[model samples]
Target: MKPQIACVLIFLSVGIALGECDELMKELGRSKTSLGGLANELVELRQIQRRVGRRIRSWEDKARQNEVYLGRLIEQRSISEGWLARFEEINRKLLAGEISSDDKEERIARNIVRIAEFQAKIDRRQATIDFRIGKIEKAQAQADLYRSRFEARESVVADIEEQRDAKKLLVLTLEADLEACKAGMA
Candidate 1:
């Protein structure tokens, strides 16, 4: 009877240990699945961050290119202004009869026309530069928004990484514990 009772006790102990082992295995599976999900999430977040960075760089590039173009347009307008001033000075001299020319009237008329037309062109270019400046400002604002989103995602990724690492440690511990438990059973 004593031997029979000892055998039943041993069987019960083995059954309980097997149950624990199964439970530990299930927990380990769950941990691995969760780790995989976290890794995938981290990857997706990184991709999103990378895209945002690209967009930011693109916006900055656009702003830089437009700034360079604007500078050129401004310089062109300055040159045109200088030319217009000289044309007006020459036309004034022609009108005042300070310069000797047989076709003085015709030359004055041509200078007037050229100054007026060039002024109009300069105004149009300035308007275009103004509009482009506004657009660059808007693009900068959008890039700032993307930067904020990237920072937010980076924070989330950090959290997920910490959780994943902890879960990985738990899985390792469980696996080691399961092996020890199995050896004991054997």
Candidate 2:
């Protein structure tokens, strides 16, 4: 009678322990699945961030190019304006009869043509520079928006990592406690 009772007690104890182990195993599996999903999301987010960074770099390069072109246009405009001023001064002298040199008259006529050409070039370059500046400004704005999104994702990634670490610690603690409980029961 004593042997039978002890055998039944052992059987019941094993069944209860097996149930608990199954439950813990299920929970661990769930945690692992969640961690895997989170990892996949992190990978996708990182790829998107890389793309945004590339776009921002492209915009910056274009902006730099436009700035250099704008500088050149400004210099050209300054030169053209200076030439026009000199040509007007020469014309005034010629009209006032203060200069009677034929060479000066011919030089002033040539300068007028040159000034017209320079003015046209300056106008064309200014238009191009203006268009490029507008494009660069738009690109910069888009880049700023992407950068903000990247930062937000970065925060999310940090949060996920922290959660995963905490979850792993929890699993470890649960496993240790479960082992101790089993040993005590035995």
Candidate 3:
């Protein structure tokens, strides 16, 4: 009777152990699936970062081109200023009676026309430069917005990875506990 009772007790313990193992296996499977989903989300975040990087590069290129154009405009303005200064000196000499009145008048008229044309060209170029600068600013703002979004996504991914690691540790601990329980029954 004692042996029979022991056999019954061992059979019941084995059955309970198997049940626990099955449950643990199911939990491990669920955890693996969750990790896989998180991995996919991480992939998406990487793609977003790549796209934002490309946008930043394009914006930088445009800004470089705008800088080159601005430099050219500055050079042109500098040249125009020199011409205006020379014209002023010639007029001053004419007013002091150092040159003939007719010659001075003709020279002054030509200088005026040249100055006006230079001013018109400068104005047009400035308007274009202003437009380009505005575009560059807008693009920079847009790129910054994207960069912030990418940072946010990166933080989220980091958090998910942390959670997944913790979950993995928990699953391992649970597995160890289940194994211990089975060993005790055996």
Best by lDDT: 1
- Scored by CA lDDT, what does every candidate get? 0.92, 0.84, 0.83
Cα error of candidate 1 at position 101, Å: 1.9
Q: What are the C-alpha RMSDs, in order, of all predicted structures?
A: 25.1, 24.7, 25.7
Error of 1 at 28 (Å): 50
Model 1: per-residue Cα lDDT over 1-186, one tens digit each: 999999999999999999999999999999999999999999999999999889756887888888888889889989989988999999999888899899998999999999998899789988988988898889878888888999999999999999999999999999999999999999
Indicate the worst ten consecutive residues by lDDT in candidate 3. Answer: 80-89
Best first by lDDT, ranked? 1, 2, 3
**Residue 25, candidate 2: alpha-carbon lDDT:** 100
TM-score of each: 0.50, 0.48, 0.53
Across 1-186, the per-residue lDDT of candidate 2 in tens digits comes to 999999999999999999999999999999999999999999999999999888757876776787787787778778777777777777778778887876876877876787778678778877877887787788678778978999999999999999999999999999999999999999
> Which model, 1 or 2, shows the larger TM-score?
1
Best TM-score goes to which candidate? Answer: 3
Give the per-residue Cα lDDT of candidate 2 at 5. Answer: 100
For candidate 3, give the lDDT of residue 150.
96
Per-candidate clashes come to: 0, 0, 0
How close to the true structure is residue 117 of candidate 2, measured as C-alpha lDDT? 81
- Enumerate residue pairs that collide in model 1: none
For model 2, the run of ten residues with the poorest summed lDDT: 55-64
